[model samples]
Target: MSEYRSLEDKLNYQFNDEQLLGLALTHRSFSNVNNERLEFLGDSILNYVISLAIFQRFDSASEGELSRMRSSLVRKETLAEIGRELDIGELIKFGIGERKSGGINRSSILADAVESIFGGILVDGGFLNASSVITRVFNKRLEKLSSDDFMKDPKSLLQEKLQDMGEPPPDYIIISTKGKSPHEVFEVACISRVLKKEARAEGASKRKAEQKAARIALTEMDRDR
Candidate 1:
């Protein structure tokens, strides 16, 4: 519990029931009384909160556009990135086997833990508190989001940008693979000869790795302009 003080500080929200927080961090691999139920509840709350936020924020957006924006915000990759930002990986309790297999950094586990924490907050404080926390955590992301950005995926956007500039489309190549079947991690590189830029990222699947790499390359290109 003492060790979680840093995490609490990062969240800017303290738990009245430390046990709820503990349960939120416990993976099924660690205990039968794990965070799955909380994750389920949190998933619902997250969707609702983000939906309402975007609805009010993007008053001009169509329903389909709002849905796409919400999906982008609540996706597993985004949640896992949030978990990493909050340092939730260190707090997750996994079974010996899972720990040995590097479960802490696994995106699925990190994303689940984040949702469970939201669920824990809801149980401890109530909907208002959970909404507050969710909004606070997602505020920056929401602020930076644009209707045009959510309309296209990173790959599509990158390709379109290159095409508009008369440059060739970027190429995605799998650079490396680790682990075994069903749990393999792939490293992919997004390369663009015209821009002389390359970005690499790792993910649970080749597609995800390619998307991440493309996102990174896009960011770098944006920075250069």
Candidate 2:
């Protein structure tokens, strides 16, 4: 009960249906009836709620800008950060195998739990109630958000900068991969032949690693110039 109290306190919401909360906390590896479906539903709702909020808040922002901001806000890394704040990892229920494999700290699992919890809230109350919870969770982030966040992601920005400088597109190589699905560490190197620059970075996913590497390469190139 005390364990649940902490989660409820962080979310600032109580569940009328305790089963929904249980289901949300249950990972696929834990049970046959799990949170995957709820994750799917919650994913859609979260995207819509965030999109609407960004749309209303940034009246002067272009469509592309709004889209970019929404992407940043709804990304797995951002959601995982929010989940950690709520202590979702401590509350998650995993199978013995998953527990042994360190699923508790996996970013993908944490993010999925956040969304699954929202899906449960949506079912227990309604869209308005779920939206209210989302608003509470994302309030600080939205407040601190800047227009600069609306710019393209690191990878896209790097590509554009290189193209404008008449440099060839950067080539990404996977330096190494470690761990299993949903919790893997991917190290990637970004090399720009024309710029004679190379940078390496590691992330929880390959795409994220590539993005980080691109950011590093771009920073190095800027420094050289």
Local accuracy of candidate 2 as per-residue lDDT tens digits, 1-225: 655878887889988988898899999999999999889889989989998999999888766567667766888889999999998897889999998999999999999999999999999989999999999999999998887765568789788877877877889999899999888999999988755657899999889999888777665664453
Best by TM-score: 2
Evaluated at residue 171, the lDDT of candidate 1 is: 88
225, model 2: CA deviation in Å?
Answer: 33
**Which whole-number lDDT from 0 to 100 does residue 180 have in model 2?**
92
The C-alpha TM-scores of every prediction are 0.68, 0.69
lDDT of 2 at 144: 86
Q: What is the lDDT of residue 87 in candidate 2?
A: 87
Q: What lDDT does each candidate get?
A: 0.88, 0.86
Residue-level lDDT tens digits of model 1 in 61-177: 765557667877888889999999999998899999999999999999999999999999999999999999999999999999899866567788789878977999998888899
